[model samples]
Target: MLEHWSSSEVDPSIRLDYWRDVAHNWVDVQPLSPGDALEASWSLLRGENCFFGTKRSTAYEMRTSPRHVPPGEDMVVISLLEAGEMRLNAAPGEHQHATAGMLGLYAPRQEACYHWGEGARQTYVALPRSVVLAALGREPGNLLLTPQRCALAPALAAQLAHLGLLARQPGRVSAVEYAGLLDATRALALLTLRNLGRQGEAADLPDLEENLHAGRHAAALRFMEQHAHRQGLDAAVIARGAGCSRTRLYEAFAAQGQTVMGALRELRLQRARAFVEHSPRLHVGALSWRCGFADPSDFSKLFRARFGLSPTEWHRRVWMEPALRRGA
Candidate 1:
C-alpha cells in the first residue's frame, strides 16, 4: 500500500511542524528553507524486500546522525533525480553534483547531506544494506553515476521508474508479481555496477560455492574493464583483484576462446573507438594515451586491425559523414 502526505493538506499554522514530523518518520531531514508557503509532498510504498518512494519539495538538507536515524533501519538509499538539481556532501570537503538522469547511492550509517534546489523532485529505492552488498559483492561507497556514462544505467533507471509506478498501484499487483519485480530490480542494479566496472571487490559468499568459478571469471572481466585506463594493468593484477589463481583465471578466459591480456586489449581498443566517435576534437596521440597505450604507433596498428582504419581516419569518417549528409 502507498501512503502519502502533503503539507498543503495541513492547517497553515502547523504546516511546518507537521511536515517535520512526517519527514522524521522516514529519515532524518531538516528544512533549510522556511516560510508559511512551504509546499511539499511525499508518497511511499513498503515491499517485502524494499521501499519505493517519490518526494517533491522545496530546498532541504539531510542530517543523518545516531540520534536522528530511525532505530533498526539499515538501508542503502538509491535516489534518482527527476527534476532540479541536488548537491551531495558525502564527506567534509567532498561534494558531488547530481542532476536529471543521474543516480546516487547512499550507504547505511554514512554521514551525508543532500541539498536540493528549488522545486526538486526525486524518486528513491531503499533496500537493506545486506541485500545490496550481496548483489554487488562489496560496499560501493557513496557513488553518483550518470546513466549516459554506462550502457546498462538507462535500463536500470527505467526499471526503477516502472517499479515506482507499480508501487503506486498496489491493488493491481499480486504478491508473486511483486517478488518478481524485486528480483528484477536487484539484478538490474548489479548489472549496472558491473557495466560501470565498479564490481569485483572481494566479498564473502556463504552459499555461492557452486558458482564460485563463474563468479571469479566474471569478476576478473569487470576488474579489467574498470582498470583498463592504467598502463600497468595485466593478467596478474586481474587475477589478484578477482581473488583467483593466475592459472585458473587464464582457464576461465580460455573457456570463452580468449586470453586475459587479449581481453584487456580489446576492452581498451573499444574504449578508444568510443572516445574517437564521441569526441571529435581529441587528437589521435592523446586518445591513444588516454586509452592506456604507451606508444601511439602500436595504438594505430591495433586500431587498423580491429576497425579496418587508423584512429584518425575513423574519427574523420564518423564526424565528417554526418555533416556531409546534412549539407546535401
Candidate 2:
C-alpha cells in the first residue's frame, strides 16, 4: 500500500502541529520556520523488511535523537537528493552538503540534523541495520558520495527512483514480486558500497581473490532470488548472470552445505508460500506455474511435504481457521 500525507489540506493555523505529528511518527523533527507557510508531502511504501519513500517540502531544520527512535527498530536510511540541497550534521563538528544527484547514508541510533533548502525533494530507502551491515560487511557511518567520486552513484540513484515508481503502483506488484525487487535493490546497494570503497578495512581486508569469490557468490544468490520464476533457470544461468564459472558457482553453494539447485528450489518454494499466504484466492495450479513449478501435481506434493498440507488446505487454514476459532 502507498500512504500519502500532505499539509495542504489542513488549516493554516494547525499545519505546523499536523506536520509535526506526521514527522514524529518517522523521526524527531521540529519545523524551524513554524511561522512561515509550510507545505510538505510524504509518500511511503512499506514492505516486509524495508521501505522506500519520498519527501518534498519547504525549508526546515530537523533533528533525530536516540529518544526519538522506536524501540527495537534499528534502521539506516539512504537518501538521494533530487532537487535543492541539504546541510547535514551527522556528528559533532562534521558537516556535509547533499546536493542534486548525491547520496547520504544515515545510521541507526545516531543523532543527526538536516537543514533542507526551500523546495527540497529527496527519495530514500530505509532498511534494517542488520540488512545494511550484511550487505556492506561493515558498519556504515554517516557517509556522502557524489557522482564525480563514485561511478555507481548514478546507477544507485536510478534504482532508488525506480523503487519509488514501483511503490506508487501497488496494483501491479504482489508480495513475492516485491520481495524480489527488494533483493535486487539490496544487491545494487552492496555494489554501490563496494565501488565507492566504503566497505572499510582496506588494509586488513581479505585477499583480492577471496573477496571477489565472496562477492560473486552473493551476487549469484541475489540473481537467483530475483529471477527464480524464469523457466529453465539453473546454475549455468546463475553463473553467467553473476559473472563466474559454473564450477565456481557450485563451489560457492557447496561451502554453505547446499547445492545450486537446492537453493533455487528453496527460493521458489519461498515465493510460493508468500503467494499462498498473501493471495489466498489464487488457484493452486496457477500459483504453481507462477512460481516456476513445471507440474501442478509436483508442486502440490512438494508444497504438502514442505508445509505439512496441500496448497488448498494451507490456504484454508491461513484464511479460515482464525474465523472458526473466533466462533468457538
Top candidate by lDDT? 2
C-alpha displacement of 153 in model 2, angstroms? 3.1
Per-residue alpha-carbon lDDT of candidate 2 for residues 122-212, written as tens digits (9 for 90 to 100): 8887888887777667776677755644578688889887776766566777767766777677677767766655534453345776566
Local error of candidate 2 at residue 72 (angstroms): 2.2
lDDT of 2 at 160: 84
Q: Per-prediction TM-score, please?
A: 0.52, 0.53
For each candidate, the alpha-carbon lDDT, in order, equals 0.71, 0.73
The clash numbers for all candidates, in the given order, read 0, 0
lDDT against true structure, model 1: 0.71
Model 2: colliding residue pairs? none
